[model samples]
Each structure stands twice: as C-alpha cells, then as structure tokens.
Target: MTTFITNFLEVFYVLIGLIMLFAGIESFRDQENPARIGTGLFWVILAVIFAGAKFLPYLVIGILILILGLLSLFKQIKPGNIKGIDEKVAEKSAQRLGGWIFMPSVVLAILSIVIAQFTPLGGQIGIGISSVVALITAAVMTHANANTTYHDSERMVRSMGTAGILPQLLAMLGAVFTASGVGELTAKAISGVFPVGNHLLGVALYCIAMAVFTMIMGNGFAAFAVITAGIGIPFVVAQGGAPVVVAALGMTSGYCGTLMTPMAANFNSLPVALMEMKDNLGVIKQQAPVATVLLVIQIGLMYVLAF
Candidate 1:
C-alpha cells in the first residue's frame, strides 16, 4: 500500500510538471507577456532537474525541451524584443574576421574527451570536459545570435559584474569543502542530533534547510551542494526514503528562496535593472508573499509524499 501511494504521488508530480511545461510554452506565443517566456524557461529547468534525478518517475523533461525548441524554431512562440540590431552587422563582420578567436577552448574540450576515452581519468573527467565544451558552445551561440560587440559583452558583464560571479564561486567553494571531507564531518555532526529515523521530520527539515540556505546563498545550485552534503543524502536516505524525493523537494524549496533574495540577481535584479527601478529590493519585496506561501506548501507536500 505504501509503495503504491508513493508511486502514485510521484506520477502526479511529473504529470503536473509536464502540464506546466506545456502551458508555459504556449503562453510564450503571446508576445505581450514576455514574462511567460521567462516563466517557461524556469519550468523547463525545473522539469529537467526533476526528471534528471528520477524523482518524478519519468524522463518527460527532455521531450518537453525538444517540443519547446521546435515551437520556437517554427515561430509558434513569438520572439520578444530584439535589441540593438542596427549595430549587429558591424559586430558580426568584425567577429568573422577576428581569426579563430574561440579555437583554444574548443581544442582543449576535444582533447579532454579524447584523453578521457583512452585514459584512467574516467567518466567524471569526460563529463567535466564535455561540460566545458558545452559552455563554450553556448557562449558562441549567444554571441553569434546577438551579434554583440566585445564592448556590449563587457558592458553587460560589468553591470552584474561581481554579483554574477559570486554564486558560481560559492558553489565551487562548497564542492572544495565536500572534497576535503568537511561535508562528511558536518553531516555526521548533524546526524548525531537528528538521528535520521523519522522520515516526515527529515523531509520537512530538509525542505526548510534548503529554503534557508538558498535564501542566503541566492543560487539553489550552491545551496543544493552544501545542504545535500550536510543533511540530504545522509539523513534522508538513512531513513529508507528515496534520495530523489529529497533532492526534488529541496530544489523546489530553493526556487522559493529565489523569489525572496536579492542574491538571485538574475531573477531579482535583472528585472529591476531592465525596468530601471530605483530600488534593487523592489522585486524581492513584491515577490516575498508568493514565495513564502509556496515554501510552506512545498514543505507540507514533501512531508506527506517524500516520507
């Protein structure tokens, strides 16, 4: 009975996620609501995360992404606001004549894959290499399509500047701490107090912890790395529940955090910047109630289902 209930909830979550994904994409066809485009991207990312960990019990995310991409290519989804096209031609010409500017990174990525295939660095190294390649590819695509000048890139980078880099740096720092075994020690210390038997309490605490950390850290990726190190994998799994549930619920809680923090400059600050708002915190303040309510609901759901 317990197994059947768990499977049913998992299926329900994935189906709802799929519906949201489709709805968000369909909303994009209405150009007046550029917000829908952003919302669609957010749902798609969430779906990917849910599906990636098998928490939702299916691989629907990849299919959703493909469908969204196809809709985009076919112009079913209206393209919102193309800025600065007048100067784009000049920029592209300069880039085309710039002589293999992106070759070095591309070469390193290919070389890394080759070495990984033949050497002992293994799957991890291969994945790392591929990720670097993918990042470079994405950057190239962005640059090519935007026809952005080096100056424009610099300006955009400088606008967010240090704020943009902080999350990635913190995440890397978290990884280093985990690698040094500090996470293991921390997990053990936390486990000593919590004791890991009550699955309901464990899931609730995990969701709460993830929300708080994400609020502080601003990026859920960093929060996930740190919290999972401290409580998630150890406490939740030891309670005989699935790690997938813990990770999914924890990440959703992090999104709730994203709604309240100025640290999530992409979500919070970008809108302010684009709108030229006098106060950076305006977006955060406006979104706080919604975030809080969602966080509460997510916690309750995690407790009921994950446990």
Candidate 2:
C-alpha cells in the first residue's frame, strides 16, 4: 500500500508537470495576448524539463534546461505578434482582475502558515497543504476574474518565470558537487603550495582565489563549490577561524568575481542584450572598477577578521 501510494504520488507529479507544459503551450498561441503566450511557454518549458528529469539523468537535463532558459531570457529575441481575438480576451480578463493578481498568493500564504501551526501533520504535511492552498487560491482568483479581459496573470508568470527558483536550483547543484569531496581535494591541492604558520596570509589567498574563480566561472555558486571544498571548510576551519564567518566572507568575495565575467550572463549579458549595446563587454567594462575595489575590501576584511 505504501509503495503504491508513493508510486501514485510520483505519477501525479509527472502528470502535473505535463499539464503545466500543455497549458503554457496553449497560452503561447494567443496572438492578441503576447504576455500570456510568453508565460505559458515558460511554464511549459519548466514543466517539461522537470518531468524529463524523472526518467532521464537529472544533471544532464538540468544543465540543458538551464542553458535553454537562460537563452530565452536574452532580450534580443523579438516577441511574436498577438492577434485581435487574443488581445480582446486578455484585456477583458485584466479588467476583471483589477490589475492586481498577486493578492491571492498573500491570502494563501497566510492560510498555509495558519494551517501549518495547528495541523497535526507537522512540517512535510504542512508544506504540502500550504502548496495546495496556494494553488487553489490562484485557481479561484483566476476563475473569479474569468470574465475579466486582463492577461496580467500570464504576463506576471512570464516576467517572474526566468527568475524563478533558478538560483536555488543552481545552489543545490553546487552543494551536491561540493559534498562529493571535490571541494576538499581542490582546497588541499591549493594549500600544498602555501607554507604553514601564515594563517592570515593563507586566508587572504583563499579569498583572492575565490574571487578569481568566481569571476572565471561567472557564478559565485560554482566557485563556492570549488573554493569551499578547497579552502573554506579545510584551511579556514583548521586555521582557527570561524567557519561561518569564513564561508560568509568567502561568498561575498565571490560577488566581486561576478562583476568581471561575461559568464555571469544574467548580470552582464542580459542587461547588454536589453540595452542593445554595441559592445558585448559594455556591462563588464563598467563594472570592472567597482568589482576590483569591492574584491579588495572583502579580501582584506576576511583576512583581518579570520586571523
């Protein structure tokens, strides 16, 4: 019975993903409602990728999905024209919703929290209940405003979709890589080159390394996986510095790296694409000075504080 229930839940998850994908695709076709179309496509892509991860290797699929999502976020792509029928329906929907669609999320959140506190099911059950409540609230809100012509919900979904939970997913991936002992091995290799007894210098070097790695990787997250394993948990901890402080400072220093790399596409490429800049490196060029200054400050601060 337990196995059957678990399998059912898994199947349900896949089904939900498929439904989202299909709805998104359908929404994308409404010519008069470009926003809804974009939103629907985004949801569909998300759902398809998530569902695909169940049967396929998650890491490969995840990387592909991430790349595709990021590419979609590039501002250079022109939106397709919306038709009259789609536009009229979307406008009507928006009018009925009064332009404020997020109201239901707030109500659902409150209800979820309330249920979480009083329910006997504890954390997992409470979370599940809360998600259901939130979904229902959104559905009810959408239905109530069904007669309204506003396509704002679809628009909202599109605008939020690219930024949606991507960072969290990346962070989780980095965590998994870090936990595989790659971080420690990398840290040890680097530490071998430095002499012992120079605790402050070592910490400073680690910070600098983190900054450089972050810049090269275009993501502090990826750098964190490597640096934390190589330097943060091992050297910083072994050197009598607080692990929390080192980890925190290390991450801050990584942001300095974000300023210098084109690989930080979200921070650099997205803006450049949006502005239609002639120079692809325009964002990085502008940010370089500020990033350098910040990096120095972070490295110095961490060294002093850690040592």
Candidate 3:
C-alpha cells in the first residue's frame, strides 16, 4: 500500500510531462505562432527533461539543462495568445453552477490534507496525489463535455507556456542542492563571517539570508530546504532555540521576499499581465512596503521567541 501510494505520486510528473508534450505539439501547428520552431522546440525540450529526468543519469540531465539555458538565452520562448472561453458562455456556466465552481478546488485542498494525514505518502507526495485527485474530480465535474475540457486544458497549458512546470523544476533543483552538499559549504562560509556564538547576530543573518535567497529563487519552498540546512539549523536551531518558532518565522521571512521580487513571476508578473496593469512594477511597488514591515516584524519575533 505504501509503495502504491508513492508510485501514484510519481505518475503526477508523468502526467505533467504528457501535458507539456501535447502543448508543444499544438504550438508547432499554431498558425499564429510568432517564433514557430523556437517556441515548439523550447517546450518539447522541457517536456523531455521533465519526463525523462527520473530515468536519465545526472550527467545527461545536466547537459539537457545547459541546452535549455541556451535556448532561453537566444529568446526562443515567446508568449502565445490566450484562447479563452467566451465571456457570456463562461458567465452563464458560472451562473448555472453558482458557488459550486469552487468545489473542486476546495476538494483539492481537502485531499491534500487527508492524504498527508492518513497515508504514508507524506506532505510532498501528498500534494502530487492531491493533484491527481483534482484531475479526476475535474473530469467528473465536467461530465461528458470532453471537447471543451480538452480544449480549455490545452489552452491553459499553452497560456502558462514554459512556465507551467516552473514550480516542479524549482523543487527538483532544491532537492539537487540538498543532495550536493551545498548546505555544508554554505554553512562553513557563513559561520566564518557571522561567528556562531553570537545568537542574535546569527539569528538575524539567517532570517535575512532566507529572505534574500527566496527573493532570488522566486519560491520560499525551494529556498526553505537550502536555507534551513545552510543557516537555520546551523545558526539558530543549534543555539538552544525553539525549532518550531524558528522554522515558522523563517518561512514567513522568505514569503516577504516573495512579495518583493519579479523573480516570483507567478505571483508578481502574472498578475500584471492578467489584469492589464499600466506599470510592470505596480504590484511590486504595492508589496514592497508591506513586505518590509513584515520582514522586520518576523525578524523581531524570531529573535524574541526563538531565544
């Protein structure tokens, strides 16, 4: 049963790869494509890396990553139009369904909670399993509207484009950092500068580092594993502090960084485009003051309670 649950999570990645592959194929045939071959090749390459990463050797995956970097460097990936649903039809459907349009999303969250609590899959795999559950529920909710479901699915894949798999890619990169002894090297380097015995300074540095790195990486989650190993555990937790308080506040510090950076494209940039905002930095500007205040409060809290 445990093995089966884990395998079910692995299948989620395969499903994502299949969706990317299908989206890449669709891009190749798009009459309105601006970059044609470049666009198709970009997503197809991502599909290959994502689908085959599990089976491929690390050296080969590294090479694929290099190729992907070069493709991006050349500006190969371009945005496509959103072939959105008709507004009147969407409104009518929403009116027909009322608040139930939100039911599947709520169920998705509930399934994640249930799977994590009751199964051996743990939280990470539980999230993957929840995605699978969400997909199944969506199919059932849509009933026999096969054509619309498929068309809309493909459009969403295309709309998100190469960025669709970014969170997955970032999580895998975080795992790679953890496995490659990066944390140890970082810990040693930082300890030299901060000095380990200065509890207040060490705690301050750890929180600051979490925020800075998370801003750079665009994900607090991806940043958390690496930062916790490199600094939080080494600097804060080792000093007879409350581990729970340190971790909770440390992650919140990272979220402050997420609010401030354009690197967090899904959060900062996507909204601007989706809302047709006049300024690209409008969202960041609004978030900056809030993020700064929160970071200050979190740092203060981490220092106060952690001691």
Candidate 4:
C-alpha cells in the first residue's frame, strides 16, 4: 500500500508538472505580457523541478530554487492576459445550478474525510484522490468539456501568478529555519526577560508567538515546529500543560495570523486577483477583526485547557 501510494504520488506530481509545462507554453504565447519570457521560464523551471526533483541532485534543485527566487525578486513573474469571466454565462450557470453549485465543494470535504478515516490510503493520499474526484465532479456537474476545463485551469494558475507556489516555498523555509536552530535562538532571546514559568504568561507567549511567526512566515505549519519548539514545549508542556491541547491550540492560533497577513498570498492575494477586487487588501481588512478575536480566544483557550 505504501509503495502504491508513493507511485501514485509520483504520477500525480508528473501530471501537475505537465500542466505547469503547458502553462509555461501558454505564457510564452501571451503577447500581452511584458515579462512573458521570464514568466515562461519560471513555469518551465518549476515544472522540471516538480517532475524531476526525486531524480535530480540536491545541488541542482538548490540552484533551481535560487533561480526561482531571482525571477520573483526581479518581478518577472506576472499574470498575463487572463480572459475575463463572461458575466452573463456565469450568472446563467449560477441561476441554473443554484445551491447545487456548491455540491462539488461538499463532496470534496466529505469524501476527503471518508477516505482518510476509512481507507489505508491515509490523509495525504486521500487528499490527492479527493481533489481529483472533486475536480471530476465539478466538471460533470457544470457540463464542462476538456477544452473548457483546460483553459480554466490554465487561467486560474496564471491568475495566481507567483503566489501559487508560496506555500511550498514557505514550508521549505520553515524546515530550513528548524534545521538552523531558529527555535533555540528564539528560546534564548525570550528566556532573558520573559517569565516562562507563569502558566498564563507562558500560554499567551506561546499563542502570540505562533500567530506572529505565522504572520511573518505566511504558514502555520511552518511556524508550528519552530514555535512549539521555542515556546510551546519549553514554556507550556514542560510547565505541566497538556501536550495535546497546547499543540492543537498553538496551531489554530497560527491560523489567526494567516487570516490577517498579506504575506499569506495564497489566502489573501489570490482571492483579490481571482475576483478582480478593486482594493488589494480587501480580504485582509475584512479578516482582521475576526483574526484578532480568534487569537485572543485561542490564547484564553490554551491557558484554560493546556493546564
């Protein structure tokens, strides 16, 4: 089962690589884009990395990553001429589908859980399988043909621009931080002035650190290892807090940061581009109040529950 899942994942990644390769080709053909060459090269390089990373040497992968960084740093990655959505067609479809338009999303969530909980495929494989299933379900329900699906997928990827890969990059950054003892440095810095033994203060520090680190890094998962190592275990768990509660609340507290930060481009910026919102920060503005409330609530919850 493990081997099968591994093989399946490899194939799935290859398929994704092919899609990105096609996107690169489309970018090259997009005459309207000023940085078309750079954009095309970006996708093509990403495709090669994705498809061949397992076989490629670490040095090669590192070089490719550096190149990707340089491209993004230079503002070479841009969304080209994405076709605007036809309002009339969209409205007609929405009216026809009504609440059924949401069925695909419903299926995606429920099916993912069902597969993860009941099957030997596990959560990661289940998520991949569920995504493909959800895509097929959406296509069938919408009567979308291959060409339509292909074009829509391409446009969506293009619209996402560089933000599409931010999560992966940030996750990698987190791993690098972890390996380089960033957490230990944080621990040393906080230990000097912060009273670590006080349960409430420790809980607050842990939760706040999670949120702030997540905001800085744009990923809760990335923040989790660092924050938990630096703050959670040393202050909370070692001080008699329940391990499970501290870990769970610590992660969600990070999500509060996710809601408020523009650095979380996948969540904040992608929506603005996709919806063509007039205000770039509209999503973050709407989410700030909720995030603030949630962070406070999480800190309280951690204090109450962890102990």
lDDT of 4 by residue, 253-276 (tens): 999999989999989999999999
Best by TM-score: 4
lDDT of 2 by residue, 1-307 (tens): 4565455456546654755564465466755554654455557666776566567777776676666566467632223342234667557867888746776677667766776588644444445556666766776766735422234344433344555546756677667767786766776677688764467776777788888898887878767766777777666767787777788989888888888888889999999899999999999999999988887887778777776
Candidate that beats the other on lDDT, 1 or 2, i.e. the better one: 2
Residue-level lDDT tens digits of model 3 in 1-307? 7787656656776776777777777778776867767777777877787677778898987787777767677887775655677899778877877888787788889888887899777777778877767877877765637677667666788888666656666667767777998877888898777788778887888888889999998889878878888899878898877999988999999999999999999899999999999999899999999999999888888889999
lDDT of model number 4: 0.88
lDDT of 1 by residue, 257-291 (tens): 88888888889999998999999899999999998
For model 2, the superposed segments whose C-alpha errors exceed 4 Å read: 1-180, 195-199, 238-248, 300-307
By TM-score rank, best first, the candidates go 4, 3, 2, 1
Cα-based lDDT for every prediction: 0.65, 0.67, 0.80, 0.88
The best candidate in terms of lDDT: 4
| Model 4 backbone overlap count | 0
Off by over 4 Å in 1: 1-175, 278-280
Q: What is the lDDT of candidate 2?
A: 0.67
Candidate 4 Cα outliers beyond 4 Å, as residue runs: 195-199, 212-229, 237-248, 251-293, 304-307
| TM-score versus the correct structure, for each prediction | 0.46, 0.53, 0.78, 0.81
Enumerate residue pairs that collide in model 3: none
